[model samples]
Target: MTNPYTTAPMPPQPPLRPAPKWARKRYVLPALALAFFIGIGAGGASGDDAKTTAAKPKSASPRPTVTVTTTAEAREPEPAPTVTATKTVKVTATPAPDTGTVADDDSGADVYYANCSEAHAAGAAPVHRGEPGYASHLDRDNDGVGCDS
Candidate 1:
């Protein structure tokens, strides 16, 4: 039988050569130009450029005293009411506040409909945060709930 799968011998590769000096020194000029430009960008005088005028010594000029005249309305804000001594008065329940009732286990929607629906149906909701009817449970974000359309 003839050997149809036989292959010829491959030729040997040539020896590696050393790179030329110029090839080895590839980016010298570009790097030097970059450094030169960087030095120029640092504001140091180079080449022919020099001060056009005299190099005067720095002298401290008194900052012009700014006499800011404020209008009468711009005076200090009125001081808030100050209490001399904080008497630690105990929190005593006087009477149940007359605010409309919210039944336990009732959802906020139910509470709103039961309490605020009538008031708000007429116009914009009058109940606001910190008002008697304003429940944080109803408006968790405290951005005013149940009537300020």
Candidate 2:
């Protein structure tokens, strides 16, 4: 007899058994796939005769056509008006007086600036080599222009 105050030892568990070969995923999946393919093939074969008997060509009706007509009236072009008049008046030409500015000089050498500061003060900073007030001393980089800064 077991003592009421003492607990009994648990029995050893049974060893695990492997799944059956037919019940494994590898075998069962392929078997189910084969059965599914067979079922589809049987169903398609039995429906072939019904499909062939029920298939009938539909009758075609002629599509409607549309016609459009347009007309334009022809008219002769109108002749332009002709008028002639003659008048004579005497005219006099006057020469403009020269203001004698640097714009009148072809060389533009008359326009002068002593330094870049003077050129900037005159609001003519970036003077090109050909333009007025451009000097080599003002252009430290000697890139043809003067007072670039």
Question: Number of the top candidate by lDDT?
Answer: 2
Error of 1 at 43 (Å): 3.1
The runs of at least 3 residues in candidate 1 whose Cα sits more than 4 Å from the true structure, single-residue gaps closed, are: 1-17, 45-54, 58-149
Taking the tens digit of each residue's C-alpha lDDT, what string does model 1 give over 6-85? Answer: 69665799999998889857878788889999987897765445553335557788887878887675578889998795
The clash numbers for all candidates, in the given order, read: 1, 0
Encode model 2's per-residue lDDT on 16-113: one tens digit a residue. Answer: 99997867988889999999999988877556777776796667989999999889889889988878763433322222355665455555445677
User: In model 1, what are the clashing residue pairs, if there are any?
Assistant: 125-147
Supply the global lDDT for candidate 2.
Answer: 0.73
What stretches of model 2 exceed 4 Å from their correct place?
1-108
Model 2: ten consecutive residues of lowest lDDT: 87-96
Q: Please, what is the whole-model Cα lDDT of each candidate in the order they appear? A: 0.56, 0.73
Alpha-carbon deviation at 126 in model 1, angstroms: 99
